[model samples]
Structure formats: C-alpha cells, structure tokens
Target: MAVLRTLLGQALRTTRLSQERTLREVSSAARVSLGYLSEVERGQKEASSELLASICRALGVRLSDVLRDVSETLSVIEPEPAPVLVPVAVPAMAGPGTTAAELRSVRRPVRDVVAAA
Candidate 1:
C-alpha cells in the first residue's frame, strides 16, 4: 500500500528541487524550522494542514496542484484488488423438470479463491 505522507513528501521535495531551492530557503520562507521541514520532506513527519499551507505558499505552488500530483502518483503505484472466485456446489444430476430457482437454492459456496492480478 502506498502511504499518503510518502507521496506528499515526494511531491514537495520534487517541487522544491525543481525550483532549485534549498531546505533553508523554503523553511525560512515558510516560517518553519529547517529540521522540521527536512523531516516532512523525508516523510518521517506528517505536516499539519496549516504547515502544509505555509509550505505550499513558500514553494509558490498551489496546494491543490501538489495534492493532485500526489494523487496521480498514488494511482499509478497502487495495486488493484484481487478478484475473488467462489466455488459453488451443484448436484451431479438434476431432473429435467428442475427449475433454475431450485438449482440456485441447492447451490452453496464451498470455498473462496482469491486470484491475484
């Protein structure tokens, strides 16, 4: 599973690096401590909503844009859920007059099979 903080941190770091700005520069502009900013960028710490806004302001990038980038990255890296197949028991022989509803009533799932994609 992809962690939201990890993706967010990557997006922030990529944006900062693209702007050729150092941690000190962004932290100073964002009015946050360099150590804290570094931790947030490394994904060791999760930034609060206010701190995130401040960082976005310092980076001169919209918070929505950063979130969108993170979301896109997450979609690409996230794995799809495995499909489940249920084994249904059916009678070996059925009468010619047996109705579909009767067959369904007699059927029961014996086991569940999870198929990986």
Candidate 2:
C-alpha cells in the first residue's frame, strides 16, 4: 500500500530494523496492544503524542530523533524540493507566567505590486 512508504511508516520500520526489534517487544515496552502497534508501525493508524513518546522510550531513543529521521527521509522523498530550515535555539518566552494571549498568532500584512505600463 501507499502508506507503507510514507515518512512515518518508514521511520517506524527503520527504527524497528535498526534495533533488530520485534513488534511484540515494542508493544510490551510501550504498554500498547501488539495488533494496534502493528497498525501504527505500518502507518495504518495515527498515533497520539503520548503513544509515540512511549514507543520512543521503549526503543531507547528520543521522540525528536525519530522526528528528525522522518523529516530527513521526507525531504528527499518527493519530486519537488522544499525550503530548508535550519534549527536554531529559540529562547523560550513562556515559562511560569506565560499567558494564552501571548501564544496566539497574529496575521502579517500582504504586499501586492502593480506593473507599470
């Protein structure tokens, strides 16, 4: 199926194979059902953040690492090239007293240019 080659599916398969691990081991370590985890690894189901984290922990890897591998694989996957973004350290603005309003998005102005005849 088309789903098998997707980034998420590829990442799951890569991770599983890289460690020479089995679905049963991941399921037991992640505290999920073997059947359900199998579906997720095959990209047949969308996994939640919590479930993903559990699986990542079970594999002795970070969620970010998995995401990075998935993204790198995704970048070279398609015909069209995408913009490359460098990860930089962003200072956290929210901590103990951050407000919801501070987290809201604000629209930016759009510019249109007219051709002079």
Which candidate has the top score in TM-score?
Answer: 1
lDDT of 2 by residue, 2-114 (tens): 34235675687678889999989988999999998888877888888899899889989898998887777666754564444333323377566866555443212222111
Error of 2 at 12 (Å): 1.9
lDDT values, one for every candidate: 0.85, 0.71
Which ten residues in a row are the worst by lDDT in model 1?
108-117
> Could you give me the TM-score of model 2 versus the true structure?
0.60
Candidate 1: count of backbone clashes, pairs at least 3 residues apart or interchain: 0
Tell me, what's the RMSD of every candidate? 7.8, 15.0
**TM-score for each model:** 0.69, 0.60
Count of clashes, each model = 0, 0
lDDT (0-100) at residue 39 of candidate 1? 91
Give the lDDT of residue 72 in candidate 2.
Answer: 72
- Those runs of model 2 whose alpha carbons end farther than 4 Å from true positions after fitting are 1-5, 79-117
